[model samples]
Target: MFSKSSNETKIAVLEERLTSYEIMIKKIDEAIQIMGKTSQTISKMLAVHEEKLDNTHKNDELIIDRIKTMESKNTEEHHRVIERFEFIDSKINDRIEILDKKVDEVTKFRWLILGGVMIISFIFSQSSMVVDILTPDTDNVRIEKPR
Candidate 1:
């Protein structure tokens, strides 16, 4: 009877150890499933992030292209405005030259008219004095009225 009890005790201890190993194996499987889920989630998030990065890169390229186009257009417009200003400058210079010639001609004509007036007065007048401020010179002049 003592030998039979010892055998039964050994069997019980073996069964308990087996049960503990089984439970440990189950826990390991659950942990492996959780790790797989976590890895899958990380992979999905990484893919989304890569897609967003690509979109942002494309948008940046588009913005750069637009800026280049605007700069080219601005340069062309600047060139056009410069040419127009040059043309206007030349026209204004030409107008100034014409006005200068006209003013010279008017001044010369005015001087000529003044000289003609002085010569006519000297030839037709009896007195040589041009402008008398105080009184008129009547020393050698005589005037009579017939009635």
Candidate 2:
């Protein structure tokens, strides 16, 4: 009788342990399902981030190309402006040279006219003195005695 009761108690204890083990396995399965869902969510987020990064890279390349094009245009425009300034400077130099020549001609003409006037005045004065010395003046004659 004691041995039968002991075997029965051992069977009951094994059954309780089996039930607890089954509950633990169910909890572990639930945790694994939740982890699977979390991993899927993380994977989706990573995929979205990768697409955004690709788009940003493309936009950066376009921006760099636009900047390079603008710089090329600016360089060409700068060269054109410099060429225009040089042309204008050459024209100004040409005009200045012509004006200098005209000024020099005018100065020479003025000097020539002044010299001609001085020569005429000197000749007239000398001729008048010679005429006065040659002409006789009888209205105011006077005699002087020498001692």
Candidate 3:
């Protein structure tokens, strides 16, 4: 009877240990499942980020191309404006030259007219003096009136 009782106690202790080990294995399985879910979530996030990066890169290229095109167009427009300004300046210079020539001609004509007037005045004044000297003195001379 003593040996039978000891064997029964040993069996009960082994059964308890087996139950604990089974519980521990169940917890370990749950932890593994959680880790797999976390890995999947991380992978999905990484894929999304990569896609966004690609789109951003494409957009940057497009923006750079547009800027280059605008710069070329601006350069062309600048050249056209410069050419137009130069043409206008040349035209103005030509007009100014023509005006200067006309002013010079007018000045010369004015001087010629003034010199002619002075010469004519001098001639008239000398002629009067000569006439007075050639005529006899009216104070000592007698004059007769004819009917």
lDDT of each: 0.92, 0.93, 0.92
Better of 1 and 2 by lDDT: 2
- The TM-score obtained by model 1 is 0.70
lDDT of 1 by residue, 81-126 (tens): 9999999999999999999999999999999999999988876564
Expressed as tens digits, the lDDT of each residue in 1-147 for candidate 2 is 569989899889999999999999999999999999999999999999999999999999999999999999999999999999999999999999999999999999999999999998777667977668667765976778987
TM-score of each: 0.70, 0.72, 0.71
In angstroms, give how far residue 125 of model 2 lies from its true place: 5.2
Residue 2, model 1: Cα distance from true site in angstroms = 11
lDDT of 3 by residue, 1-147 (tens): 569878889888889989999999999999999999999999999999999999999999999999999999999999999999999999999999999999999999999999999998788668977668767777766677986
Query: Candidate 1, overall lDDT?
Result: 0.92
Candidate 3 collision pairs: none
Sort order, TM-score high to low: 2, 3, 1
How far does residue 40 in candidate 3 sit from its true spot (Å)?
Answer: 1.5
Q: Give the higher-lDDT candidate: 2 or 3.
A: 2
